[model samples]
Target chain A: MSWSFSIGSISGIRIRIHLTFALFFIWIGAAFWNEGGMAAMANGLAYILLLFLCVVLHEFGHILTARRFGSQTLDVVLLPIGGVARMKCIPEKPGQELAVALAGPGVNLVIAAVLFILLGSQTIMQDVAQPAKNVSLLSQLAVANIALAVFNLVPAFPMDGGRALRACLSYRMDRAAATKLATRIGHILAFGFGLFGFVSGYPLLMLVALFVFMGASAENNSTQLHQLARRLRVSDAMITQFSTLPVTSRIADAVALLIHSTQHDIPIVDGVGKPIGLLTRARLLRALHDLGADGQVADVMRTDVPTVSDRAELEDALRLMDEENFPAVMVADQRGHLIGMVTLENLDQMLLLARLQPRE
Target chain B: MSWSFSIGSISGIRIRIHLTFALFFIWIGAAFWNEGGMAAMANGLAYILLLFLCVVLHEFGHILTARRFGSQTLDVVLLPIGGVARMKCIPEKPGQELAVALAGPGVNLVIAAVLFILLGSQTIMQDVAQPAKNVSLLSQLAVANIALAVFNLVPAFPMDGGRALRACLSYRMDRAAATKLATRIGHILAFGFGLFGFVSGYPLLMLVALFVFMGASAENNSTQLHQLARRLRVSDAMITQFSTLPVTSRIADAVALLIHSTQHDIPIVDGVGKPIGLLTRARLLRALHDLGADGQVADVMRTDVPTVSDRAELEDALRLMDEENFPAVMVADQRGHLIGMVTLENLDQMLLLARLQPRE
Candidate 1:
């Protein structure tokens, strides 16, 4: 996922081209070029490009639909295998998810239909069916669209059809259970594809098989983790006994406190016993190295940290922390009173416990 | 990274084989089977499998060396293109990093050397070179090892050579700047490979080109972000003031706190003024839905959350939180006294500011 590049943005959704896609085009061009001339090579290249454009549009269909369901699209990256639309969050509602999943292949279907109608009206059915050695660009594009629609319709995880199946099943069972079922179906499909590709001598089909298998497994794991996070709450995993420091404290006093206490983070509180900021060891070291022991705590305290209530959803809080790239959060009470602090270490301990616990 | 399956652990490092690697074998078998018969298919399959084994050994070389430098390897995943060893952390010391990176290609060199020596002693070089159009397994394996070593030495990120280059440069320049330099060189190599592949009609070369391009770009981005994180601290981005609830508080009290204070998590403190646990809104709702208003706050509170010292490193804190899967971490002072809480929202704000801040 990290090893990709964004080409541009279309309708606010970023479009990325995977590095391997270029190899696909190059191979296609070379394999066909020797049989004809520059025209044949160009034609093959054009067809591959057109196919990928359709793939991009298909991904966009999912992106736009997900957007409507209150989810944000991170980006759509094109790989040699296919395009992937990274949705920030999939909707919990079965209907919304189903609609989003269907939107992709639906766009491809429309493209194929339009092409079919055009070819039919022009009496070019024969040319469309058995494309000539040097096929026309329009006919090639049409055929590619049709192929795209058909291929994507195969039930496989990371494929539109598979997603649709999962969404539908989620309506009957819990999302996690539905995902598990979908993964099972995906594995079966992967085996089928692998067997078919080996028998048919189509290497691309093998790639599809691999994609489906991996995607299904990833989806299952992510869904399970999310379910666990949803069932838990922030308070269920926070550390309570911590330390604090007043803003008026001197560097010498902070140092003395650090020497006597096990805490590393010193929360700077105001005269009214309200936390105003925090002073970390890194900051203290810099201050000590630059201004010596006489410097005030307020001079090095940071005030841009996030705070949370003691009762927020654990999953939501974790997600927020991950997205914001923060290390810790401050907790408060009903009267805006500083109570305790939480950090990444406390979260890890909880996760470790959860992992060690016997499953129900 | 997330699209692979772990096979088992080897020398304390997880071994994962991507589904695509299986596809690679299937494709080789199919291509050869069509060209000849079952024997030819078996020959091709054996060659590919042996080649991948060499790839695994190459990755193990990196892993073993990295271990010596106090870096833990998370896993080694085989892809269609090659193998990837995901290390827990890269050594900052230039010498150690350089040694670890060079270890990979060193394994390939040894394999090739061993094969050459065996062939020479057995006087089977000629027979190995021509095995009636099926190709000898030993000969093919030797050639593949040599090829792997050379290809990986082409200086590209996500590759052994590129890391070696970065390590060497890091000694003289900042890590981020060295990464940028190496990435530039990698891009140049990628373009060169693409051009060569286009003219020479080699699909594999084209694939390598794409891999280099994407890998370099990713390395550049990751290094840039890491540099930023290293320069910042937790105190620079934690939130101070927040709402909470007492340990004796009732469900109705929590609901009122949620409504009036907009606080979603409340820390429950005992008579000794120590935080005993946390009462989150999700738990409160579940308690109310299951046990009614008579449920005590202590009965629904969570006791296994993470806590952070006010002076902890921001990057370390974030990493711990991510690993632990904690929603929020409590911040404490020198006396193990509860100060405040830090959550994801505060971290996001800090990142936004860091990103938007004007450079001198």
Candidate 2:
């Protein structure tokens, strides 16, 4: 996000520009100007920008279809290689995934067809085959689209082609199994691309290969996490037995506990035992350093907390934790009272257990 | 990690090879065989393998220096691009960082020096210039080493050159300010490189630009988080007045609470007001689906919890949570009691507040 900025939006989805993506245009302009003066630079910039627009349209094709299946794409980011649609959640159904995956390349194919008609196939082919002369902008655009379509259809992980393959395989096996197979295929394809690029000294192909390879691995891990989420519950991994502090205690009291107790975070409660705030060990030292140990517990304790019922699923808890980027959540009972806590460690244990004994 | 396998270990640092990295050789062998026959194939593979070994050695130059400064490196992974040392915690001291940053390039420089002496400058240049034929493997190696050193010295994020620049800048300004300046310079440099790559049609330069740009942003965020961790405590953001559940509660009771309470995770406590376990919201629904609402809370709640003293630093708590991979951790007071909770949501508010009021 730091390297990208919002360009605009399509409906609710924001279209963003990666900083380097914009730089690519400026780079093209500067380099072309150095080589062939202003006219060539202008032509080059125009050509690059048009190609980018086509890539954006291709991403939209995927984004729009995904939206129909309740997948919300937050951003469409433009990079040199292609446009990436950042969808936080993808539809799980294989049928829907197949449609979503195919939509992008499908758009490119249509664009190529339309451009070919507009430019005339004979003239377009003539322009496409030549690099120095008789090249129409239309033909170049058509060729770019066609290349995008063909390249995307190579069938590998991290690509539309790979997703389509996974979707098809999912019909015969489980989603995870299908994804694993697809990811392997993607790796092989990426290796092929990278090897070809290295020997031929083509950086573009090498970068593509890296992306495909990394994507395959990352996708597999994400799918595995999803499966774990579905099969587990918060109760399966919540931690019990921790220390607490009274609301009347001062920073000195908390510090004393920090030295004596292994606990680095203490929950503070009122006289009647209703929770009021939490004081972490770091806060304790910080307070001692800044406010002195005399600082009242009420003044230093954190009071903004969220509690969850202990009967919840680990999946929802994991989602909540991810969104919060926090390590722990408190658990509550039917009477709306704090009873336990769930930490990232607990979740890891549960995940490990589930992985080891999936049927359990 | 799924796409990488450990070949062995040096001291404690594991040497891992990315799957594609190994496949690159196979790809070279097959591609070369098709294009130039056995002699060419053998020569090509030998050249690539030797280059990768240099890269690995360059990485060792970094890892050894970092280890001396107490930064633990778990893996040194080889890829076609280069070698990556996965250092968990980088040394923060400006001098240490500078040393760690320069070591890899320094090693490359040394290798170049030694190779120059071995191959003789005249022969090396001839071999490096005409890579297609009349190439001495030794001369090719010297050129590769020199190129590596030169490329890595380009001041940018995600690269050692940028780190070195930042380290130098840190002496004149605050660490945060220095990083910001360095990042901007890195971005501009990345843009320049990318432009040059595009114009000259060099894919390697373009990928390096992308890595630099992204690394700058990621590094800045990480540094800011570290700063925040030092200045803030769990108390600054711990949520208070949250709901809790009693140990005696049943799944049906939790169901009642779930419908009425906004809390998703419920902490369960004993009669004397001591925490026993935590149940998450997802677990509530899952338990209902799997075990019915009549199931006992004692049987389903998570009990393996870790507690921290309320006086502990938020940084420590954050580390604990990260290691635990949990959503929440219980806060304990002097009496070893769970008085409050800190959830990921609370941490977010704290982080947001800290960012807004850095001085505070």
Q: Judged by TM-score, which candidate is best?
A: 2
Give the alpha-carbon lDDT of every model.
0.72, 0.76
Q: What lDDT tens digits, residue by residue, belong to model 2 across residues A208-271?
A: 8998999898888667666777776666555555566788888767765553333456777766
What tens digits encode model 2's per-residue C-alpha lDDT throughout B132-216? 6577877878878888988887888668888899999988998888888999998999888876775566766776778778878
Best by lDDT: 2
Scored against the true structure, residue B338 in model 1 reaches a CA lDDT of 67
Residue B274 of candidate 1: its Cα lDDT?
62
TM-score, structure 1 vs. true? 0.50
Error of 1 at A101 (Å): 15
Model 1: per-residue Cα lDDT over A144-196, one tens digit each? 77677777877776577788888889889998888888889999999899778
What candidate 2 gets wrong by more than 4 Å, as runs, is: A132-134, A241-306, A319-329, A340-349, B1-360
